[model samples]
Structure formats: C-alpha cells, structure tokens
Target chain A: MSIHRKNVLGAVFLAILGLLPLFLNSYWVDVLNSIGIYAILGLSLNLIVGHSGLFNLGHAAFYAVGAYTAAILNTHFHIPVLWLLPLCALTAGLFALVIARPIIHLRGDYLCIVTIGIGEIVRIALINNIFGITGGANGIFGISRPSILGLTLRTPTHFFYLILVFTLLTIFLFHLLEYSRFGRALNFLREDAVAAEGSGINTAHYKLAAFVLGAAWAGMVGNIYAAKMTIISPESFTFWESVLMFAIVILGGSGSIFGVLLGAALIVGLPELFREFASARMLVFGAAMVAMMIFRTQGILPPRPRSYDLFETVEGERKA
Target chain B: MSLLSIQRLTKNFGGLTAVNNVSFDVEQGSVVGLIGPNGAGKTTVFNLITGIYQPDQGAISFEQASLLRLPTHRIVSLGIARTFQTIRLFQNMSVLENVLAGCHCRMKSGILSSMFHFPRQQREERAAIDRALKALDFVGLRDQAENLSKNLSYGNQRLLEIARALGTEPRLLVLDEPAGGMNENETAQLVSLIERIRGMGITVLLIEHDMSLVMRVCEQIVVLEYGSKIAEGSPEEIQRNERVIAAYLGTEDG
Candidate 1:
C-alpha cells in the first residue's frame, strides 16, 4: 500500500476505535481491554520467539512472577500498585535471568522443553505457597486500583484508557528497538547464529538479552492485569496462557509488530464475538487456526527483509 | 613477520585425531594455502583457529596475543575472520544486511544508545552501511545489495561470503573451499580476488582441494596427511616434493 493510503486507512481505524467505548456496553469494553493487554503481551513475545527465533513456550512464568510480585508488595506493604510496575519488571527479568542463564545454551527443541519445565515449576511453586507470600491456591486479593491525580480508576472504561495508553507506549518504544542496532543483531542471530558469532556478535549475550527484554515487558503487562482484576491466582497464569500468547505471535506473522496486534485482536476478540457458539467456540477457533496456518505458512504478515536507507551516494568527491 | 602462528596445535574427536600436532605460520600480506586429500582435517584447523573447536594441546597466538580460550566473538575483534567450507550466508537476510552484520564487530553502540537511536549510534549505523557497501563492491556484488542472499547463485554466494568476511575489517582472512564448485573461468576470477585482497594488505589462509587454484594464488603451501603437516614451502618446492606427490597419489601409506 502507498504511504498516503496506509495513513488514511490508519486514521479511519483510529476514528472508529476512539468512538468504540461510547457505543459498547461495559462487558464489551472489558473485552477490548483484555485484547489490548494481550496485544502488548504478543508484542513482547515477538521480540524473543519471532525476531530472535527462540521458542519460548514458558513465557507465563515471567508473567506470573510479575503479577505475584505486585500482588505481594501492594497488598502487604501498601506501595500503590502503579508504583510497582518497574519493580515488577525487574523481578520478572531477574527471574528469567536466573532460570534461563544455564539453559540458554540448549537450542531448538531442547530449549523449548526446558523452558516448559521452568514455567510449570514456577506455577506449581506459586500454588504450593513458596516463601509464604503467594497465598497458595486462594491467592492474594484486595489489591488496590491505581490512582491518577487523586482519582481511583475503578470501572472498565477507566482501565480501557489505562491499557490503551501503556500499549501505545510499548508500540513506540518497540518500534525504536526494531530499527536499532541491537534489533539488527537479533535478526542476524535468528538467521545464522554461528555466522553472527563469527562476525563478532556474542550469541550467548544477545540471546539472553532478548529473553530478558521480552520477559520484562510481559512483567509490566502483569502489573496492569493485577490492578485490573484486583485479584490474581495461579489459575490466571497457566501453561495454556503461555500457549495462547505464543499462538498470538505465530498467527500475527512473528516479527511484525502490527501483525501481532492483529493476531491479538483475532485471538482475543474473536472468541468473545462468537460467544453465541457457546461450546463450539473453541472447536471453531482451533479449526480456524489450523486452516489459517495451512493457507499462509508465514502467518498473516511475514516479516519483510530490513533495508538500511544508508545507501546515499557519498556526495563529496567529484572528479578530485 | 607472521600475523597468525600455530605451534603444536592438536584436537581429538573421540578416537580419531582430527588435527594432530598441526603447525603453520601465515605471514603478513601473504596468501597461504592449507590443502590435503579429503578428511585431512583442513577445516578442523580453521575451526581451531576461529575458536570453534578448542585445541587439545599447544597454543595459538594472533598478532602476538595468546588466543587460547578466548571466545569466538572476541577472536573476530582481534582482527581474525573466517568463512565456512559450505556457504553460510545469513540466507533470509538481504545481501547488504549480511555485510552490515559483518561490520558488527567494529560497531561500539551499546544496547541503550542503540535503542534510543542516539546520535553516536546513528553515526555508527551509517558508517557500518557504507563499509558494507564497500565490501560488496570489493566482490562485485554491490548491484545485488538489496536482494535476499538465498536467491543468489552458487558463484555469487561464494563471493558474498568473502564480502561478509571482509566487512569484519580483519588483518587475517580465512576461507575454506572458496572455489569448491566453480568452473575454470570462475576459479580464475577467485584467484584474482585473493590477489586483490592481498594487495589490500590483509593476510589470507585458505583450505582448498583444488590444486590448480591453490598452485596459482598461494605464495606458500602447507600439505597435510591424516591431520599432520607433511610439507610446507613455495609452490615449486611442493610440486617436486616426493612425499607430497605420494600423498596426493594415495600411495603414501603403501
């Protein structure tokens, strides 16, 4: 599409989105809020799985770490949930560091298997009440909602705006990262790790950085989720949640940020829209995912090869 | 003076000694050839030099610093770069991108500065792209800069590998089987390319099964048999060495 046409289309889409909360009921608003959350989640996962070609089936381990960190700090110490976003991210990033450090050497299916075990271990530990902090199966509740300018955000519309703003922030920062030198190195890592290392990129360092970055972003999302539900349990962060997030990255065309948002919309919003299907919703969804993969092996939007606009003819030497 | 020196280097994979007590010196601004019959461990020697396989015994020093136990990435930063036996281009990446990635060693942009597109980082990125273009131009693939690497033909793929290695700005360039499947015309082009690279003051070491290419471009040739150095001399000296002839004729053991 031409740049002008894309901009016009984007403007129209934003206009519809701006007017959506006005016409939709609170239930649908809540659904849209969830979609925004998953969109952020999908984008974070894309940094690792899509761009770096690391199979991370245990992403919810990091998410759970973030949610539980916020729940404990806010409910026990009363630190105000919003203030804990950075702390939540640090905890999850550290958790990923501790867990993924040794196993990062294992590539392909072995890495995937080890990560799966790590996620299960974290979830099971939370359920068993490790450190006497998780509140076991009942989970910690009564977490306070975030307040902005002395206004406590309580309703669905309030959270829709909260998630919307943060999601936009993620999009902007990740866009910068996508074009950055680090991002290009990650692409090289994904394509041929040995060659990347031969070219002087520390493969181990880059891979670990990708995992930590992705996990930190997921942890930030977890902070918002804890505040929204005001209660978080082990059930909220299951293996299935990790699978769904992975599915979103895959369905959206792995490395493309815009494609991830589209995937998140289809994955999160479609199920709610087809609530009329009742029990058949999941069956239909599974069938649709299978059919889509068959039709477009590269997802809805495969990543385009990156081109640096640095080919400008050096304009200084004219027949000197 | 030598740029890369190997003394009593050894590597063993289980019962087999892949590279057994192999030693050689690649002098500055010279093209050295490492040649043998198949399975003579020429590629293994390259792997050891690049730190892909750690040596079982002895030491490697490049530019007078001990390269023993330094990581592969660190070795590249020390002005040593190598291409693989089979073409190992970043297949999904564009031709320009492949060289840009090769220029990664010279780049000093950290994670934070790069993410923010700070002025220093932006300048480095531009310099890297220009250097990449220059490397592509060196191998005559500059016109295919934006094409995906996998779409290139066999000869182009080999040149692209050399270009990517050159983009590292190495003092020593190691190529494994640079003209493996090329016709005579392409091989002639490769001979001149190596000569051009030497003219640029970079030392070259290559492992080749093709004797004609090796005899043509190499100033010094090291012959190996079952991972041991059998002979090392000028091409004329190697051509008349009886053991070298026997090794090639497959009658050395008999």
Candidate 2:
C-alpha cells in the first residue's frame, strides 16, 4: 500500500478502536482489552522471535515473573500495583539476562527447546512456591487496582483506555526501534550470523539484549495484566500463554508492527468470536491457522524492505 | 611494517590438519592473493584470520595487536572486514540496510537513544546512511539500494557483499573467492573494484582461484598446497615457481 493510504487506513482503524468500548458491552470491551494485552506481549516477543530471529518459546516465564513480582510485593506490602511497573520490568529483564546469558549461543531448535524448558521450570517454580512468597498453587490474590490522579481503574472501559494508551506507546517506541541502528543490527544477525559478525555486529551481545528487552517489556505488560484481573496465579501464565504470544507474532507477520496487532486481534479476538461454534470452533480455528500458514508463509503482513530518500542527493551528484 | 602478520598458523580438525605451519605478511596498502586447489585449506586460513576458528597454535596479529583470542565481531571492529565466498548477504533486508548493518560497529546509539532518536543518534544514523550509500555507489549498486538483496543478480549480490564490508571502514578488507562465479565482465569490474579499494589506501587479503584476475590485481601472491605454504612472491614469481606449477599440475611421477 502507498504510504498515504496506509496512514489513512491506520487512522480510521485507530478511530474505530478508540470508540469501540462505547458501542460494545462490558464483556466485549474486556475482549478488546485482552487483545490489547496480547498485542503488547506479541510486540515484545517480536523483538526476539521476529527482528532478532531468536526462537524464544518461554516468553511467559518473563510475564509470570513480572506478575508474581507485582502480586507478591503488592499483597504483602500493600504497595500500589501501578508503582511496581518498573520493578516488574526490572525483575523480568534480570531474569532473562541470567537465563539468556548462558544459552544465547544455542541456535534454532535447540534454543526453542531450552526456552520451553525454561517456561515449564518457571511455572513449576511458581507452583512449588520456591521462595514461600509466591503463595503456591492457589497463587496470590487481591492485587490493588492501578490508579492515576486518585482515580482507580475499576471498569473494563477504564482499563481499556489505559491499555490503549500503553499499546500506542509500545507501537511508537517499537516503531522507532524497528528502524534504528540497533534494530538493523538485530535484523542483520538474524539473517546471517556469520556475515553479521564479519560486518562488525556482536551477535551474542545483540541477541542477549533482545532477549532482555523483550522480557522487560513483557514484564510491564504483566503488571497491567495483574492489575486488570486483580488476582494472579500460576494458571494465568502457562506454556499455553507463551504459545499464544508466539503464534500471534508468527501468524500475524513476525517483523511488522501492524501485522502483529492484526494477528493479536485475529488470534485473541477470533477465539472469542468462535465461542458460538461451541466444540467445532477449535477445529475451524485450527484449519484456518493451517490454511493461513500455507497461503501466507511470510505472515499476514510481511514487513516491507526499508527505503531511504537518497535519490535526490544521488541525482544531484550525477549532474554535478 | 606488515598490516597483518601471521606466524605458524595451524588448525586441526580431528585427524586432518586443515592449515599447518603457515606464516605470511600482508603489507600495508597492498593487495595479496592466497591461491590453492580444492581442500587445500585456503578458506580455513581466512577463517583463522577472522577468528571464526581459533588456531591450535599460531599468533595472528593486525597492526601489532594479537587477534588469536578475539571474537569474529571484535576482529572486524579492530578494522578487518570480510566477504564470504558463498555471498552471505542479508537476503531479506534492503540493499541499503545490508550496508547499513556494516556501519553498525561504528555507530554508538544505545537502546534509549535509538528508540528516542536523540540528536546525537539521529546525526550518527544520518552519517551511517550516507556512508552506506557511498559504499553502494562505489560498487555501482546505489540505484538498487531500496531493493531486497536476494532480488539482486548473483554478481550484484557479490558486489553488495563488498559494499557491506566496506561500510565498516576497515583498514584491511578480506575477500574469499570474490570472483568465484562472476562472468568476464563481472570479474573485470571486480578487478577494478579491488584496484579502487587499494587506491583508497586500504590493505586487501583475498583467496581466489581466478588466476588471471589475481595476476592482474595482486601485488603479492601466496600459494598453498596441502595445508602448507609452498610459495610467496610477486604474481610473476608465483606463476613460474616449480612447486606452485607442480601443485597446480601434478608431477609426472605422481
């Protein structure tokens, strides 16, 4: 699509989304909130699985860490959940750094397997209540609702606005990151590690950074999730959650932001829409996913190649 | 003084010595060629120099700093950039982005600066883009900057690799079989490109089987046979050396 048309389409889409909560009932607004949450999570995962080409299937471990951190701290100390955003991000980022440091060098399927193990380990640890702080299988409860300027976010509509704003911020920041020197380095390493290394990119360092950054962002989303639900458990973050996030990125289009958003909508929102189908919904969803994979192997919206406006300068040089 | 120095470089894979007791000097601002038959370990030497594989016993230094224990990316940062024999371009990225990746080592934007587009980061990014474009222009691929690298012709892909390597602004540029699959016209263009690279005061080290192109562009030539250096001299001297000739064409007894 032309840049102008894309901008117009994006604006119209955002306007519709902005006004969606008013037209829909509470349950549907909550669904949009779910999509928003998944969209942010997918964007975070995209940094690793999409741009950096790291096979990270344990992303939920970071999310769980973030949620548990908030849940434990907020329940015990009565600390406001909103105040723990940065702290949650820190804990999750640090957790990723510790895990990824040793295993970042493993390639492809091996990395994927290791990440799956890590996800399971985190879930089991939460269940076992290793630190005695996680509250074991029952999980932590009564997370204080997030608030701003003395106004608590009590309803789905309130949380939707919060999620929408955060999602927009994520898209903006990630958009910048996607075009930055750092983003380019990640893409280069993803394409060909040896060539990227020979071209002066520190592959291991960049890979580790992507893991940490993606985890940190997911952690922040975990804080929002805890606040929205007001109760947290090991059940909320599972191998299945990580799989959904991964699928959202891959099925949506790995490297494109708009694609991930569209994917989050389809993956998260479609399942809800299919509820009327009862038992047949999953079969339809599965077949649809298979067909999409076969038809658009690159994703629903593959990222366009980057272009620069150097033509004018080049033409001027040629004339000169 | 030599720009890059290798002393007794040896690498063993299981029972086989891919490179053994090989020592050479690449003079500053000179084009040097390493020639050998198949499985003669020409690419292995490049790997060792670039730190892809650590030598079992050797001291490889660039500008007097040892590269023995350094990683491949660090080697490039210390002013050595290389192109692979198989043409390893970022196939899905734009031609310009491929070269921009080469400018990565020189860029200094951290995550926050990059995400926020701070003035310093923007300036550095603009400079990197200009440098990348200049490298593309040097290789005659400026017009294809926006195209995906995989969409480029095979010969153009090779040129794109060179352009990507040049984005590093390296003091020594290493190429593995740059003219391996190029037609005559492309090979001729490669010869002139190598000349222009040297003209810009960069030292070059290359491994090539194309003797005609090598003889025309290389000021110094090193010949390897069965993982050992057999001859080191000017192109004409290497062409006439008995062992070098015998290595290329089997001896009567053999």
CA lDDT, every model vs. true structure: 0.90, 0.93
Error of 2 at B77 (Å): 0.7
Best by lDDT: 2
Q: Model 2, A1-320: lDDT tens per residue?
A: 69899999989988998998889999999999999999999999999999999999999999999998888899999899989999999999999999999999999999999999999999999999987998899988888888999999999999999999999999999998887998888898899998898899989999999999999999999999999998888999899999999999999998899899999999999989979889998899889889989999889998877666564344226322
Candidate 2 segments whose C-alpha is farther than 4 A from its true place? A1-5, A311-320
Q: Write the per-residue lDDT of candidate 2 for residues B1-254, one digit (tens) a residue.
A: 99999999999999999998999999999999999899999999999999999999989999998998899999999999999999899999899999998899999998899889998887788778888989999999998989999999999999999999999999999999999889999999999999999999999999999999999999899999899999999998998999988999989999
Q: What is the C-alpha RMSD, rounded to one decimal, of candidate 1?
A: 2.0
Name the top TM-score candidate.
2
Interface RMSD of each: 1.4, 1.4
As for candidate 1, its clashing pairs are none
Model 1 agreement with the true structure over B1-254: per-residue lDDT tens digits? 68899999899999999988988898999999999889999999999999998999978999889899999999998999898888888998899988887898889887778668898888778778878989998999989999999999898899999999999899999999999888888888999999999999999999998899999999999999999999999999999999999988857458
Model 1: per-residue Cα lDDT at residue A295 = 96
Off by over 4 Å in 1: A313-320, B252-254
Please give the range of 10 consecutive residues that has the lowest summed lDDT in model 1 chain A.
A311-320
Ignoring the other chain, what TM-score does chain B have in each prediction? 0.97, 0.99
Highest DockQ model number: 2
